[model samples]
Target: MIISIIHLLSSCQDFLDEKPSTDLVVPDNLEDIQALLDNEYIMNRNSDMGEVASDDYFISKQEWESWNEITRNAHVWADIISPTGRFVSWNALYEQVFYANVALEQLDDIVPDSNEQVDWDRLRGSALFYRSSAFYNLLRIFTMPYHLVNPELGIPLKLSADVNKLVKRSSIEDSYAQVIGDLEAALDLLPSRATIATRPSKQAVYGLLARVYLSMGDYQKVLDYTSLALELGNELMDYANLEQGNTFGFKRLNEEMVYCSYFSSGSIGYSSDTFILSEIYESYAAGDLRKSLFFTQAYQDGHVKFRGTYMGNLYLFDGIATDELLLNRAEAAVRLGNEEQALEDLNYLLEHRFEAGKFEPIAGISGEVLLERILEERRKELVFRGLRWEDLRRFSGSQYEKTVTRDLDGEIYTLEPGSPKYAYPIPMDELQLNDMKQNPR
Candidate 1:
C-alpha cells in the first residue's frame, strides 16, 4: 500500500514544514523544473476534509469516541482541529500551488531550442494544470459554493513564487475565473494525451473544466467540454472483470482514469470502525457488479467497507476519470433538454457496471425524472472519490438539495443545505499569518 502524505503526516509532524527558502539551490534547467512538478507528494495529493464530512460512510459511536479530534469533528461537520497542530488540507493544497509557481517562474528564464520545445511545453502545461487543480480544490473546501447567492470570499490566488508576498482572498467570482483562465491556457499547450496518467493532458483539462462549469451552473460549457473530453476517451472499466475477492479490486492508473491522483486519508479513512452507510450499500442491486467489486463484508462483525478504490489499495483516488466525464456530459445534456443523449451516456456506463447478462438500458425517461436518475447514479458511481462534498454544495437550495446527517453517541448532527458550514472555517493559522478575512463559521 502506498501510504500518501495524509498517512505520513500522522507520524511525521515536520514532513511538510519546509519553507520555499531562497538559500536553497534554484531550479534553473528544464530537468530541474520538471523534477519539481513530478513530485507526487506535492502535486498529486489533495485535501480529504470534504470526503470525511460527506455522507458516504459513518463511524460507530464507540469508535467515534475513541478516534482522534479531526476525525470526530469532520464527521459531524463540527469545527476541526488538526492533530498535527496545523490544518493539513489547507497547508498541503497551498504547497502544491507553491511548487507550481516555482516551476512556472523558473520556466520563464529557459528558452528551449526546437529539440526541447515539446518537453518544455509539457512541463509548463503540467504546471498550469496542477496550479489550477489545486486552486479548484481549495475553493471547493475553503470557499462558498459557486452557486450560492453572493458567495463568501474566495481563497487567495497565489500566482507567484515569492514566499514573502501575501495575496488576500479574492471575490468568489474572480477566484473561479482564475481557475478557468489557467485551464484554458493549459489546453493549448498540453498534448491530447499524456504518456502517464499522473501527468495532465488536454483531455484532463477538458474534464476539469466540465466539472468547474457544472459547479457554476454553466450547462452549455459543461456539455461542450465533456463532449470534447469523451470524444478523446470514454472507456469505462468492466467491474465484472475485476477480481471481487481481492482486498482492493481496481488498479492504479486504470484506462478510465485520465489523470491519476489521490486525496488525504483522513482519520476515518478505510478503518474497521468506518463502515459504509446502509443506504449507500443497499442502493446497488444484487446484479450490480459494484456491490461486490466496490465493497466487501470482510469485517469480523460483517460491516461493509469500501475496498474498490481505483488506486488499487487503501489510498483514495480523487483524480479525473472518463466515468465522471460521462456523468458530467449526461447531466449537462439533460439540463439542456436533450434527454436522449443524456440517457445514452448514462446507460453506456451502467451497462459495464452490471452483471454481463443482467444489464438493461434505461429508457422512457425525460425531463426532471431523467435528470434525477443521472444525479443518483453520480452519487453511487463516484462514491468516496471526494466528489460528493462538491455535489452536496452545488445542489444546495436547488430541487436536488439534501440535508446530510450523522449519528455518533446517539446524537444526530445535520448539515443543512446552503449552510455556511459548507465552507469550512479558514484555519486560524492562515488568518494569523496573512491577516486575511476568515470564512463565516
Candidate 2:
C-alpha cells in the first residue's frame, strides 16, 4: 500500500494513510535513498544559525557598535561552555548528524540489484563526512587544545541514530580518535568526484583529513592528505579570469573549494557589506589583484563604504578548495622544518595574487618566519570563511593576538581574548532541559 508522510517539526507520528517519521523513512529503493540524501544536502545548505552567530565573518560595524553587546552576551564565541551559545551550536550540529545517522542506518535495506553498489557507498560516505564535519566543529569550539596530549575536558561524542539516550562527554583524545575514524572510513567509501558540488567526494574526505590532522598537530599527516587532495587538479582560481557579477567572483570558494555552503542575501538576513581591517589591507603590496578583486570601495560623506563585500558566501555553495590545501601544506612544511618548501608554497599563492613578476621570495627567512608568513597569508586569504575563529582557538598560544578595535561615538573599544565575555553562556532553556555542566564564567 502507498503511504504518505507528514513531516512535522518536533515529533514523529503516523496517520492511517501516512507513514511514520514524516521527515525520514526507510527507503524502499535506491531512488528513495537518493531523495533522502538530497534532504541531507538541504540541511547543510540552510544550517546557518551557527555561522550567523560566529565571528568568522561580519561583526558589529561602527554603525552598530551596540550590537556587539548582544553578540558578546548571546553569540560571542569563546569557550564551548556557554549554555545559550553552546546549546545553539551543539543542537544544530547534532541535528545534522541525526539526519546523517538516519540515512546511514537505512543503507543496508536497499536492494543491491536496484542500486549501484558504488552509489550506496557514496551516500554512506557523504553521510559519514557530514557527521565527522559536525563533530570536528564541536571539538574545535568546545574542547581545549587538541594537542594537549591527554585532555581532561572534551565534548561529548555522539555516534548512533538513537537520540533518546543521554550521551556523556568524551575526552579530547577520544573525540579526535572518533573524528579521525569517521573521516578515514568516509574516504574509503566516497567517490573521487561527483557530477554535482553538493555531494562529498573522495577528495573532499582527504581535504577534511588534512584539516583534522593539522588540528591534531600532525604536520606529516597534514602534508600527506593535502598532497593527495591537490593531485585531484583542484587548482586555485586565477583572479585574472574573474569578471563582475560572476557568481564565483569572490576568492573564498570556487573550483578550488573541496566543500562549501551556499549563501544568498535573503538567506543570510544581514548586509553583505564587508570591511577589511586597514592594517590587513595595507599589508598587500601594489599590483596585488586580491585587494581589488576581493573588495570594493565606496565613499559616502567622507566615510568609507565597503558594502556588498562578500565574505565567503556560505549559502551559495560551500566546498573544499585547493587554497586551503595550499595553506595547509605551507604550514605543514614550516612545522616539518622545510623552510624552503614552505616559502615555495607561500610564494606560489602570492604569485597568483599579485601581477606577474611582482612576486619575490624573501631571503634569510628561517622556518619560524616562514611559518608566520604562511599564517599571515592564511589570515588574508581565509577571512570570513569560518576558519578565523578556529584559527584563533588553534593558535591561541601563538604570537597572534585575538583583538579587534572599534571606534564608536567618540569612544574607542578594544576586545581581547580572556575577557570576562570571551565565550558565550549556555542558553537558559538548555540548562532547564539537561543537568549539563555550564562553562565557568
Candidate 3:
C-alpha cells in the first residue's frame, strides 16, 4: 500500500523533491511508529500561505514591495512562477503526508499480541488521521473549489512510504474520496478522546469530519459530525471568567480546544494600517466581550489589531475548537430547517461570548434570516482563524457572494469568486518536475 517517489532528481532538491529510489523506512516496532506520529514537525500547522491568501488580512504597500517575487505574485493573485518566492508550506505539509504514509505502510508487518492490540490500533489510527489531515488541507489549498471538482487532477495522493511509488495527481473526486476514506478508517480506531490537544482522538476525528462535510456543503453531515463532536468535548470558554487586555483571552489546550495547530505570520498583517471592516468590528453589541478581548488599538491611527488567537500568541491558530463546532452545528441546523436547534446552539455559544448578564438570546428569527444571523456570528467569532478563504469560496455562488478587493497605494487587487485565481497556481518547481498538469487560469 505504500506509494512514494522512485526516481532520482538533482542534488539541490529537498524533501519535497523526488529523489533516487530507496527502500521505505518502516519503523521496527509500534513505538517507533508512535514516535513518527509524535513528530510535530509534520503535525503542526505550517506557515501563513493560505492565511495571506485569505481575505482576513491585508499588508501595506511597503510590506508588499519588500516581499520576494513569489510572495508578491501570490499577494496580488498572480500565478506564482518561483515557489521559493512563496511560503514553504507546500513542502512542509507534504512532508507530513509522506511520514504518515511511512507509519501506515510499516504497520502491515506488525502482529500484535492480545495485550498489544489496543496500542497497535491507536497508532494506526493516529497515522491515518495525520495523513488525512495533511491531504485535506492540501486539497483545500491547491485544488479547485469543490463545486468545480471534476476529473481534472488535484494534488497527488501520496499514500506510501516507499520512494518508488509514482506521485501523480488524482482527479478532484478521487482526491476527496481518498481523504474521506482515510478519515473514516481512522475514526473507529481512535480513542474516545486524546490525552492532549496535539493527538487525534475520536473528538478530533469528528471535528475534522464536520470541517470536511462543511467544505463540501453537506449541511446534514456537518450537523451530524458536529453533534457527535460536542457530545464528547463541548466545553465553551465563558467570557465571564476571561481576563481582558491580554493577547489571548483563551489559553492553550483549554476545554474549548479539541485539537491545536497554528499558522505563523509577521507583525505586518497584525498591524492596523489596513483595518478590520468597521461595520463588522462595530457589529458587536455593547456587552459583547470579544470586541475587547480579541482586539487592541494599533499604533496606526484609526486602526485596530487582532489580539485573540487560540495559540495565545502572534501565530495564527487553525485547529478545531468546540466553539467552531457549535457555529457549524448552528449553521447546518438552520440550513436543515432545525431552527430551534440552531437557536439553542447559537445561544449557548453567544452566552459564553457575551458579558454574563448582559447577553440576550436572539429570538423570532427563522429561515434564511436566522441562517444569516448564524453565519454573521461565525464571521465575527472566527476571524483570523484560517476559515475565511474557504468561507469566501463556499459562499461565492450564494446570496453571500463576496468579491474581495484591496486598495493598495490607490491600485486595486481583487479576488473574485469563481475565478481561476480561486485555485492558486501550483508551485512552479512542481510543474517543472512532475507529470501533474498545472491549473489553467
> Which candidate gets the maximum TM-score versus the true structure?
1
Task: Compute each candidate's TM-score over C-alphas.
Answer: 0.94, 0.80, 0.91
Error of 1 at 399 (Å): 1.5
Off by over 4 Å in 1: 1-20, 80-85, 149-152, 298-302
* Residue-by-residue lDDT tens digits, candidate 1, 322-394: 8999999999999999888899999999999998899878998899999989998998899889899999899
Top-lDDT structure, candidate number:
1
- Per lDDT, what order, best first? 1, 3, 2
TM-score of 2: 0.80
For candidate 1, give the lDDT of residue 63. 79
1-441 per-residue lDDT for model 3 (tens digits): 012222222221544454344542447799898887886645776555556677765667887777766567766787663556333667767777878877777788888999989999998898888888888888777776788654675788887775556688888888888888888999999998889888888899899989988888999999999999999968898987888857666677778889888774453345444456666678889899999887775536666667788888666688999989999999999999899999999999999988769998999989999999998999899988878778877887889988888778899988888777777667776656666787766
Q: Residue 152 in model 3: shift from native, Å?
A: 1.6
For model 2, how does the per-residue alpha-carbon lDDT over 1-441 read when each residue is reduced to its tens digit? 113222432222232124334563466665676776675333454333333343433333543443333333333333443423334455666766776776787886665654488778888888888888888776655455464323645665667766655666577778888888888988878878656556788888888899888877789999898888878865676666666454334644356666655432222234444344566666667877766665554433222222222334333333467778889998998889877777777777777777767767655787677778788888777654556555654554556647644443444555454343333344456556555555444
Tell me the lDDT of model 3 at 3.
Answer: 27
- Residue-pair clashes per candidate: 0, 29, 6
Where does model 3 exceed 4 Å of error? 1-26, 81-87, 264-275
